[model samples]
Target: MSIPIDDLPDIPADLIDEIKAFLRLDHDEDDPAIAEMAGSASLLCESFTRQLLVARMAQDMLPVKNVWQKLSRLPVQAIDLVESVAADGLTQELSSDDYIVDIDSDGQGWIRLQTAVSVSRVRVSYAAGLVADWEEVPTMLRQGIVRMTGYFYANRDSNDVHQLPHAVSALWRPYRRMRMG
Candidate 1:
């Protein structure tokens, strides 16, 4: 399960204006609505590519088992909290020495226990993504978001984007390699 500990980043208003520039239109009359479109497009692009455009805190819960298990999101930035909740509603904070975080698996994150516990007891709080702020988001992702926002804004009349666009595809291919199909 995925538990978000913070609010997802908002699509910057300036970006909405950039999309507007691309579409050759202007004014704050529709700025609020256009900004909303930018956010929606960011969501779609992130979902399609399985990438977190901005860093956020989240907790991923995994069932107990002897083997290693993958974390909920990609490009695992850091692991903050590790706790094991028992069947009788008891939660024990796990020591950092007890487990390992393996982000070397490309985009995927992995964790393995040093010792076994009861079933369904593992919980991990971590930061996962490329950057922590919208201003610091990668150029490719930002461009992709702008393009996607343009697509969404233009398609308001028809809603006919049947699939992900090629430019976005090219931007995401390498990142998608480690994501499970």
Candidate 2:
């Protein structure tokens, strides 16, 4: 499994004024709550899409199976380490020449092994994401978060809320990573 090593996303709050405009509210009044909700929406969007909305370091402990293995996150910027884990779950550095990482913005890439080993664990440390900050997050994703925040805020009284709204989903769909069988 892969684990994010970054602190809470340095993702900036969505533009409160933009949200206010979308809601058709008077410009003079500010809904401070939208800032917090926007952050939540961004995190939720990241979680739902399994794509990091901001750039940061991450690690994954995966069993080295077959000659190819997918890295934990897509849009991987760099690979810091490739280690072997012992039966006791301890990590030790491995030579970089043993494998090659192929990554792309589409988030479809894998490590190609040069030689097989009996070790059951391989740990990968890498930096991956669309951008390093909220400002750099894709326009559609930022818009989606705003849309979601607005949806949640407007639907605060609704009892049955289970998924992201259609508009928000459409905006995020293109960025979502597709699984191949």
Candidate 3:
């Protein structure tokens, strides 16, 4: 059975009201209502974060299986659309980071491909000190000075560097395989 958004636990109306109240307070800093609203929004954010983590896990495991099974029953034309997009380089590396392989109910679906690469800095730290002089410097200064920085980078520099090549290929695989057979 598919998990529905409606089935998820609801956010209380009072909490939502508080969020609105806080937003209003942000505009008018003198309002005492802002404090209560800020507190409510913080609590709500934490609650939603937890719920989102659970939901993501369920989505990753469950919906993938269900979608694949459903796709298997789709018409040949839908599969063909996917193959056409793949052949046309719709999943090419210059696109954004996410791609949609749509298989419409009418047996005609299209592939929308996006590719993105993100680079971020990673800090590595080391401590080198005379064992006897370790206590002379403040802990905060020592910690700050001992850090080294490096970048974690990924880019689709070429057409082959795209992350979803298999998913894109899989989108058309059924049709191609069928044609071959």
Candidate 4:
């Protein structure tokens, strides 16, 4: 179900042309139009190159697996445990915390976790859940919660961008509470 970069919508020719024009490639002889074009092309090329590298890395790291199919094979009790934990409603019986948890279909064929909690005020956020790989569940849970808490702790170092882990942790806390309860 994954769409390759080639399958994505084409970048607009007008935008490219506008970018080219904005660089003022036709100006001075020392910094001529050709040099400007080359500079612009180089920038664009580098962006695409980085994107491809990241895509490849992600593909290599995350292999395709039939998560739902495997989950379906679990015993009814185990399946219920997963459902309840994922749903987050089971937290109420275990804690008096005013938190609401919900699941969302990511449209890309995965489920995500959303949480709304009231401290001094109501705060809401969401976290992307891991693919249904039971073996990766523990690590994924930790990572996903961190991400939802607004902290970007990916396995690999990214382009110097740090995500907020607090938001991710907030979203995932309920699920953890439910499981323990």
Candidate 5:
């Protein structure tokens, strides 16, 4: 499960302007609408890649089945707090000494506990993402987002927003995080 602690980052002004230029709009009348489309496009790319383009804080409720448990989010930047939640809704915060964070070869996040946990579940508040800033996002992802936004703008009057262009997927496919069952 994912619980976002803050609002997602907005599409940068420069990028918005770039999209407007792609749409060949010299006027700012539709700037807000364009920005919204850009934001949606960014999220679409992020979802397809299963990666967060910007750093974000989120909490995950995970089962305590072993000493080391994999976190739901990848590229975990930092662990803010870890607590065990009881059936009655009480929470016990774990100490730093109780567990350690580990990043596997695949960049997956894991938390190793010194001892096995008795709790059925734990809530971990963590920061995770691929880049710290929007500017740090890869060029391919940015271009994919721009293209998707342009597509959305072009099809605003129809049901075509549900359709994702092949080019956008091609650009973002390399960054997709493959999950195994």
Candidate 6:
């Protein structure tokens, strides 16, 4: 499992303006609300694609199944720390010489231990994402997020809606990572 160690970045002001323009709004009264909706849209995009939209610190815990293990998030920028947690509640930080880290061409992260160790789980802290800033995010993703924000704003009163529009899903499908158990 992977846990975010930092809060998601706030929606950029330019994005809020773009969403407002897309909705053809003439007022700034709802800027804060729209920002919130945009944030939600970003989360939906991330969730649907199974990828982080911006750079951030994250921690992952994996069972010691073999000499190597895959980190949950992809496009890993760097591995900051790796620790082995023993069954008796002891933890040992692994040095650089103890393991090797690789991000494959597919953008998945892999860590391989150079030596054998008895442990129940491994804890990894790393940075992973597709882009470092909102402007660096893919154009399709930004467009989808804008449209989704409009959808959310327009349908705010409808409590029955539970899924993203087909267009949004279509825009994000190509970026979706296939997860396997």
Question: What RMSD, rounded to one decimal, does every model reach?
Answer: 2.4, 3.0, 24.5, 19.9, 1.7, 1.9
Q: Backbone clashes per model, in order?
A: 1, 0, 6, 17, 0, 0
Structural similarity to truth (TM-score) of each candidate: 0.84, 0.80, 0.16, 0.20, 0.91, 0.90
lDDT of each: 0.76, 0.77, 0.26, 0.26, 0.84, 0.88
Indicate which candidate wins on lDDT.
Answer: 6
The segments of candidate 3 whose C-alpha lies over 4 angstroms from its true place after superposition are: 1-8, 25-181
lDDT of 2: 0.77
Put down candidate 2 lDDT per residue, 14-129, tens digits, no spaces. 46767767777675444666777777888888877778878889888878765777886767888888888889877778787777877765665577656675688888888888
lDDT of 5: 0.84
Model 1 ranges with Cα > 4 A deviation:
87-90, 105-107, 178-181
Looking at model 5, how many pairs of residues clash? 0
Evaluated at residue 90, the lDDT of candidate 6 is 85
lDDT tens string, model 6, 1-181? 8878977898899999999999999899999999999999998888889888998888998776556688887678888998998887688998788788888887788988776668878888999889999999999999999999999999999997788799998888889998887
Q: Give the alpha carbon lDDT tens digit for every residue of 1-181 in model 1.
A: 9777876677676787777888788567878778888888777766766777688877888887767888877668887778998788678888777787677756567888887665577888888887777888777777777777777777888867798678876765555534446
Error of 4 at 84 (Å): 30
Distance from true position, residue 97, model 3, in Å?
A: 41
* Weakest 10 consecutive residues of candidate 4 by summed lDDT: 53-62
Give lDDT tens digits, candidate 5, residues 22-49.
Answer: 8898999888999999989988887898
Give me the displacement of residue 132 in model 6, in angstroms.
1.0
Pairing residues by index, what is the TM-score of model 1? 0.84
Alpha carbon lDDT of residue 164, candidate 3? 27
- Model 6's C-alpha root-mean-square deviation from the true structure amounts to 1.9
